[model samples]
Target: MDLNKKIRVFVVDDSMVFRNFLIKSIGQSPRFEVIGHAINAFDAERQIPQLKPDVVTLDIEMPGMTGPDFLRKFLPKYPVPVILVSSLNLRVFDALEVGAVDFVRKPDVKDEITSKQFVSTLLPKLLIASNSRVRMPRGTVSSAPATTMEARQLQTPTPRTMEHFAGENKIVAIGASTGGTEAILDVVRNFPANMPGVVITQHMPAGFTAMYAERLNKILKMEVREAKNGDKVRQGLMLIAPGGYQMRLVKRGTEYFVSCTIEEKVNGHAPSVDVLFNSVAQNARDQAIGVILTGMGSDGAAGLLRMRKNGAFTIGQDKETCVVYGMPMEAYKIGAVCQQAPLLTIPSIIYRQLGLLTK
Candidate 1:
């Protein structure tokens, strides 16, 4: 835990080629050292005790035991920060729910662009995971609810229609990173299928946003999809800004839509929350609701402040419910947040603001 010491990393994957690639790529960085490599969970379980790595990069589809299974078994006994290296699939979220810190989409080794993208994404995540406090799986924490409000709300189907809010052209803009996958899900899933249109920017690498959106669509009543260039922003639909691209809200005539473009990293993140929030400030103004969730940086703080100055309602997740408390804390400090609440209460709070429910 010495601040001066290089972060020691353990790489776990089934492919020998990938293991070597990771070792070589990580070796090039002065900040990280690949202390050990494992082909599967069994190998990792044995070597982890001796190697005592500062961080672990895991593969989800390994033979014998999958990544999620390993986390359920290992974290309780030997709590260590785990970063999942996965394909564009739902398994990554499953791993996060079980206690992995974050994930990077697996790069296609044959493609040069993808390989470079992998390195750009992996390096920062390793650093973040190294400094993070790993928590026990939600299932193990008996004091808190195992299932989020979204899941329970879905069970008793509410047939609320969007007809009443037809005149309110409001949009919700959300931003998150670090532990945001589950945090955002907890908020979005509770939203009624007929709620106002929503847009999100989650700090994720290329090829993962589509899958993440698809996963949310399956559980939530609302239609969720990865934002496309010139996609119309409409009620009951949630557009996730595609990873590696910047999404901005633009008004055409009386209607609003998003313009997705590849741009330089803003505040050290592409698909940056700042980019999305600033756009909302310019376009939606007082008609928008901005929410800053758990993350690791100040990317959205200034943008949230801009939105508030422009008269948009803003909310920040309370530190007690946040996995990192960095982004929301920064927003709160800068007077960007109009209200702060725990994760579970966010959806209801949004509904109250929109007049969907009596406060």
Candidate 2:
């Protein structure tokens, strides 16, 4: 971003108090300029195109026209990044599917601590959003594995399809932030249910990870859930690191389990991808495949490089397919990634590298 030009932001919320709070909070930032505010989506639509703000902070529960509805009708005509500020709920994902760049959950109990916490997260997201790619109705997440295979491969793997799948003791570790929710789902949904157990760290606030895990479980063939302290890393399961915790890979007597604990935030994120990837680098070593997906910042770059140096294959999402092109770009710059591929092709790339897919 040009230093001379401050990031222009537009605020949209139903509650006057909340709207004023946003305006006041954002106004304090020298990097951000609150160009305008709207009490509803209808007003926002009218003002946004004319105002042409760089970013939009929206509340999903707006009266008359909801956030998702507005995104559906508005984004195509006037492309702009939108950050949803919503209470803990699944509807925010609906907004995300429609093209919202990111979301900040409303403080459960409005207080000094909560407000500061909210801003600390929101400001960085706003910075990320300012540089993010706003996909119109975002690409449809591929459910099929990226390989030439029959449906049986995903459900019940045959001898040929299951080649190298058993006794491999390999695992895939994925990390993302920003546009990660759908991206993570996109990659994992393609894996066979028998694929080696995978772990993921997506930067999210506390309380949302469980919901995200539950949502992923419903959409995926493999079992998905938020990681608990002693959750085993086994075949056919995808464990998402719970928010507000640092999850590490622990090897105990030929079995792998996760250790999740409340810890100091790393790289400005509680569930830092670096922390997880570093643990994988140390524990899983050469038996891991590290994937850094679409996200902002350099959280996973160092850890990914560590994984690569330790003989683990690492992949970064290519710039063309990334939302912010920050994390993967940083990783690629540092030679941490063995290869960079488009988002949709990454699953196949992993499988191919593991000799699980045909050329």
Candidate 3:
């Protein structure tokens, strides 16, 4: 591979060893190039403006100014994709909430496996972020408003066939890529404990989804956990597809559950949102609701459309609320989405449609 289209990366960490490790790893791959390295956020602040790298790998803990504080000051000014390299701590969540694109666990000095894993995990996100728009200032997240006619024009009748899916054993399936964890958590947290089963594919690496599930379970009214092979899709439970495996629906008679197994990537993702959504569309069809959330690619669009064709109700998170707006936008373009709602409203809309809640 000539690897000519290199993604320019800026490395920031207080540790020289880690910085050099990252530089070497990135250099070994022709797809990425290290443009600059900084020991702390102040140095980063000065150098970033000069380098203007396409992506930045930032350390959560630094001597003078922390990553989040740096982000508080720098993000508003330079809103590009930022991936946090951090230890397992509360700060990771804070970094996530602050709009860090992705995260990787820091590796020790002598651990080649861990270092390789971090490099592999980061490559995909960096590739995806390369095509993304520049970050806007914090608190200015909203985009231009839509015209009344444009809003009205976009609204379509919720398909009547979707009503039949409201019966027992119903499960809602969602899939997304870059910028999806927060999006999924925001939607899932709003559901009451007694809501139907939910399964999600968020394009995360091994070991991350379990932690994400644990985090969501703490805040959500319903149960949230990473899916293991043979896990039952029970009511009030949200199962996230574990990283490094494909999750599909296994139905025997009326009972259905998630089946986790290693499989090739579909649409550039293993355990793809489409794989799960399509399985539900095939097995649960009239008893499933498929949602396509914010992401950088068309991974879930075709599958959500398949769900619609199979008589499942379908929803797409609208553009203004999405971090990337690529996945939902594609689904909407194909007429796959029956209901398009902002992230905040999606939960209520789903609950209302399922008769789980009254308007």
Candidate 4:
């Protein structure tokens, strides 16, 4: 951890070609140094301890010992920040849940344009991973069982109660980055299927958001899918903003829908939280609920403030529960958050704010 020493990195991939490419690309940066590499988890397991690298870039699919398995074994012992480099797949999320810090999609090595694009996306993530906090994997975790909207209605206050607050028109907007994958799942899984429509913007590359949406749909009773250009925003459905694009809320008559389109990066990210929150500020106004979760930077702070100024109810995840407190901290500092809550409490807070519960 010397300030003068460049961050040392260890690369692990099954492909020798990719390992070399990564070493060359990462080594070019004066801030980083490629110390060593291994072909798979076994090789990495043997060499990593001796190298004592600051960061490790890993591959998801390998000849033996998949990335998630490696993480489950390695993190508990060594506790070094690890970044997964792979093609877009659901297993990437599984790895993140197990404890990998972040991920970068594998580029087409034969294509010059894609190779350059890959480096652009990777270098920053490498820097972020190096400084990220590594957490120990837990043995047991509990999640709320998925229930149908009707079943949820039977347990909570009736729709009659929510009708008084114009809850039918309410929309929830959530944004996150860095440690977002697990944090988002924790909040969303606790939601009842009858809750208001939710829109999420989690910083991720293209090709992975679809799988993320698919994964969420399997676990939550509500319909979940990657947002399309004109998908309707409605109760019992959650729209995750597609990666590599920007998603904004638009009103048609009395109904709300999302407009997902390719656009320049806002606040240093595509599918940015700022873009989504600003749209809610302009379109949904007081009918919107804005929640900013864990992340590395201030991407959503300004937009959350705008939402608050526009009379939207805003919440930020408390620092104690956040994996990285950057986004929520920034929002809280600017008076954007009307309330701050722990990760497990956020869903209930949203329901209460919508007048769905007496508590």
The 0-to-1 C-alpha lDDT of every candidate, in the order given, reads 0.88, 0.88, 0.80, 0.87
Q: Write the per-residue lDDT of candidate 3 for residues 9-110, one digit (tens) a residue.
A: 999999988889888887788788899999999999999988988889899989989988888777766787888888765576667667677677777759
- In candidate 1, residue 228 scores what lDDT? 98
What TM-score, over all chains together, does every model reach?
0.88, 0.91, 0.81, 0.89
Per TM-score, what order, best first?
Answer: 2, 4, 1, 3
TM-score of 4: 0.89
Model 1 bad stretches (over 4 Å):
108-117, 141-162
Q: For residues 1-359, could you state the per-residue lDDT of candidate 2 as single tens digits?
A: 69788999999998988888999998999999999999999999899988999999999987799999999888877879999999998888889888899999887446989999889889989998998998778544446564543232334222225645543588899999999998887787767777788999999988889999999898987899999999999988999999999999999988899999999999988899999999999999999999999998899999999999998999999887788899999999999999998787777777776667644
Q: Distance from true position, residue 54, model 4, in Å?
A: 1.8
Alpha carbon deviation, residue 82, candidate 1 (Å): 0.8
**Residue-level lDDT for 173 in candidate 1:** 97
lDDT of 4 by residue, 144-205 (tens): 55355424432433222322354767999999998898889877775667778899999998
Among all windows of ten consecutive residues in candidate 2, which has the lowest summed lDDT?
151-160
